[model samples]
Target: MISRASLRFSLGRFTTAEEIDAAAAKLVAVVTHLRQNAPAFEFD
Candidate 1:
């Protein structure tokens, strides 16, 4: 699981793009990272 700390860390360094795309991109990256590294973890 990608902890809230990691998400906060990623968002903390960014100052722009606070709209939908930015959020979508971040979520996608998080999901991708988790999926790749934690295949046995249930996302549902």
Candidate 2:
């Protein structure tokens, strides 16, 4: 779902401050993109 919805954001390998910050930025970007572009996906 991450790959299908996000812009090639790779996760699960962050251990430094820069990497964590980048991950957070990527996450925000993904959520914003999905909110404005992708259809709403609700969990049941």
TM-score for all models, in order of appearance: 0.46, 0.53
**Each prediction's Cα lDDT score?**
0.64, 0.67
Candidate 2 versus truth, CA RMSD in Å, comes to 6.5
In the order shown, the candidates' Cα RMSDs to the true structure are 5.9, 6.5
Instruction: List candidate 2 segments past 4 Å from native.
Output: 1-14, 40-44
lDDT of 2 at 15: 62
Stretches of candidate 1 exceeding 4 Å from the true structure: 1-18, 39-44
List pairs with backbone clashes in candidate 1.
Answer: none
Q: How much is 23 displaced in model 2, in angstroms?
A: 0.1
lDDT of 1 by residue, 1-44 (tens): 43433544344454566665777898899888877786454443
Number of the top-ranking candidate, with lDDT as the measure:
2
